[model samples]
Target: MRRRLSFFACLGVAVERVMTDNGGCYRSREFNAALAAEGVRHIYTRPYSPWQNGKVERMNRTLALEWQYGRAWDSEAGKASTLPAFIEHYNWGRPHSACGGAAAHAAHRRRKQPFGTQQLVIHAFRKSSISM
Candidate 1:
């Protein structure tokens, strides 16, 4: 939570209100006090109605499906250490059809591209895996 808070702090915006469900963490006095210190309001949703935070809930489901299930982890440490790398690839390497077949990093770059203008091209060179 601290890391995420610091990350949002680096964006230079004090959180005004955080809409969340009635999770224990959100209901904790300490967490509520922390939000007060940051001048953020806390808004809780009705239980069992996840549609209130549907975006985050859907993204969480995607992460579990796309990255977590059916994967082997040798150890807990290995899983923990690999998360950052996986997240980097998810943000930069994975192409999204929603973003017109471009990765998030690339999409951010060409966000202002003029209509009917040519955009940057990315090429991949496959390396041979076996030697004769």
Candidate 2:
């Protein structure tokens, strides 16, 4: 838990909330307390509702396809040995459509901008620039 918090700090991310399935570890008092100390909130998905956690579910499916079965390994040890490289490739090199075509690592480093074309259009709409 300390390591996870430290990782987020190193990434300059103040994790406001996390959504996960109601797993035993996630529901544990110790885990919840640690997150609370960091001012983070936990949200649980309803049972058997993968769509409720759509992004994570899609990522899990992606990993199975791209890493687990993407290549033939001589042994579990071989796969484990190459896991770090695969992770690096996935985070830093691969462009994710869900991340607006940015690599995951790059996307994670970005902060939300207050102003954008969408925000500008919405501001105009609120001022009645266009009518229904």
Candidate 3:
């Protein structure tokens, strides 16, 4: 939760609400009181409906692919220490197909809008025909 707060702060967005699963920590009265004090709305997803937070779920899949399956971390401590570094690389270095194959870091620098995979495939075909 603290990490989430820091992330939102870095992004310059005030979290007006929080959506969470029925985790014990989130369901605690203290946690709800805190949210109330901060005037941030709290939304709990229906059980078995994790897709309510699709973006986060997708990112978890990406993390599993990029780090959990691909990397070798022998111990918990090692994985914990490397997590921040991995997140930085994922946010800044990784190329997202949804973002037009451009590195996330480069997206902020470039002015052009992203082209989806279908657009890329069509563009490639057009280029080949023009060359022929």
> Of the candidates shown, which would achieve the greatest lDDT relative to the real structure?
2
lDDT of 3: 0.61
How badly does each model clash, as a count of residue pairs? 0, 0, 0
Per-residue error at 14 for model 1, in Å? 3.7
Can you write out model 2's per-residue Cα lDDT over 1-132, one digit (the tens) per residue?
A: 666666656755556676767767778899789879888777788999979877666656666688778778788777767766875686578998967999855665574542221111000011121111
Off by over 4 Å in 2: 105-132
Query: lDDT of candidate 2 vs native?
Result: 0.62
TM-score, each model?
Answer: 0.64, 0.71, 0.65
Candidate no. 1 TM-score: 0.64
Off by over 4 Å in 3: 1-11, 103-132
All candidates in order of TM-score, best leading: 2, 3, 1
lDDT of each: 0.59, 0.62, 0.61
Which prediction has more favorable lDDT, 1 or 2?
A: 2
True-structure RMSD, every candidate: 11.9, 13.9, 13.8
| Of candidates 3 and 2, the better by lDDT | 2
lDDT of 1 by residue, 2-59 (tens): 4545564664434456677676767889878887776767777789998987645654
Q: Pick the candidate with the highest TM-score.
A: 2
Local accuracy of candidate 3 as per-residue lDDT tens digits, 6-125 = 455565556677777676777889878877877778888798997886655666677667765667778757666776687677667888886689876476557454322111110001
